[model samples]
Target: MAQAGTFVFLDYYGRLAIERGFVKPEAEDEDENGEALPSTSGAAKPKVPTISHSAALIEDLTAHKTAALRVELANNPDVALVAVVHAMLLSVAYPYNSEQSALQLTLTPERLEPSMKNAESCKGLSAFNDLADNYGHHLPGNPAELFDWLLEQPQDIVLSLLAFGAAHSVNAVEKKFTDRKKGIEQANQLGRALKVNMPDWFETTGDSYFKHVNRMTIELSLAEARGSEAELSVRAAAKKSEAVTIADRLVAGTGWIPSPLRIAPSEAEQELGAESIAEDEQFPQAAE
Candidate 1:
């Protein structure tokens, strides 16, 4: 099933592949006057070196899906759910290097554990266990050399991760409904953490599920912004009301609320009227 899906994807890629090098316009047998041409001296469309299918896939895998091929892949569950997941992480665990030492590292048991207690210690661990568990096959030597090895990663593993991401986004939205203020704060914090913890992972595998995740993320940001705007509006309204209240009281001839340092007019006019009041008392010295 996996091999069949891969070839189908490859066929799609081949059709979309661009031709390499400058495309010369059809050589004219004759000039505009219908006479034999002497020399070929017209500017040609610069041949863009054909981008490889793998490179195109990588770009589509890393960027927004603008092509028709991407739209088809998104709709097809078999290809969308499995092949993309596998390809996104294809070179992750086992890097393609010719060194024999790197090849031998593939035999480590920890490397083989998907749910390892210590992921760092498991580098190059042979995926023999995955094969035994029907999740993946152990590549005998350098696994990176063979495309077949990548095609064999367990579909279950790929699908499970995709489902988990989708569910997490849904859960985040639900949390905001129940406790909006804290929820927005928490979501923003989590988004920032994801940016920090998995910067490279996001860059490579982000496109695999970006469309599924981007909408909810945008909502979270907009919700937070709305909350902030509401708070600011309330404060501005409150200040406006206070100013109106003071103006009304003044017009009515009831004394307005005094400044923080001043007593009401009764206390202020008497002492303030005294011409002998010390300058130090009128304007208190600053505290040391």
Candidate 2:
């Protein structure tokens, strides 16, 4: 089953993709004679490049329908997405590169070009050619920016690409990033804005914790969760499964859920003040 997320940014991103793909595109540029504009000095014009396939992807992704997203990709090929996928698969194809340690996160252009080219050939997507032509050596910026861009994508496939690309291809070439906390905060803020039903909104169980992360990491989490001394001792002595049981009650919800749920503001709240609407308009700055 497809997982729900905090931010629902597909609608805006989908529209952006369609607009870039067709509406008033640069390809429509014309001269005064109503003929296609000539490049300066009679030079051939470079192909215009922009993001694409967002709207189609958005339809499936917004609903968290991963299966539907694959069907969309099958019916309508997108080059950018293909490049993103094939490139990511290579990262895990080998043993972890722990020996050649560096903080860099993006794949080298030389290694990536052939893979993208192969996908472009297979998919028959000229957009891949555009992507290679323009951004083969480069990708979008930091994790926060990448996460922000991911939310803007319309499909689960596209979103997953950005996520994968950041960790695999894009990050390989990029330099070591320092502000991990900011990226996390950005994610939390986006989740809150999008109104996602966060998994953690449920009582955290040993199963959820042990499955995803190393058990020792719970020590830090316990500290942040403000567990009791007894709970801390439990975390130290008990298995991760047992530790999480105590940890659950110590933590507050992450704010993504509508906790302390209640009705929205009443008409009296909407009125806000004793002054009438017209009176407020007359004294424009008074409310401020």
lDDT by residue (1-288, candidate 1, tens digit) is 111111112234565443333323444346466786543346554544445668778897666644665678668876566544333333333444324221112221122244433444432233322433332233334544434443465767556544432322222332223655654446545555445333221221122221233333323322333444433333343343442332332223222221221222333455876644676578987999
The residue-by-residue lDDT of candidate 2 on 106-159, one tens digit each, is 453224445331333333235444544443333343322333443355677565
Lowest summed lDDT window (length 10), candidate 1: 1-10
- Stretches of candidate 1 above 4 Å error? 1-66, 96-154, 157-288
Q: List the residue pairs that clash in candidate 2.
A: 57-154, 57-155, 58-154, 105-171, 105-172, 106-171, 106-172, 106-173
| lDDT of model 1, residue 26 | 49
Error of 1 at 188 (Å): 11
RMSD (Cα, Å) for all candidates, in order, is: 28.3, 27.6
User: Candidate 1: what lDDT?
Assistant: 0.38
Candidate 1 scores a C-alpha RMSD against the true structure in Å of 28.3
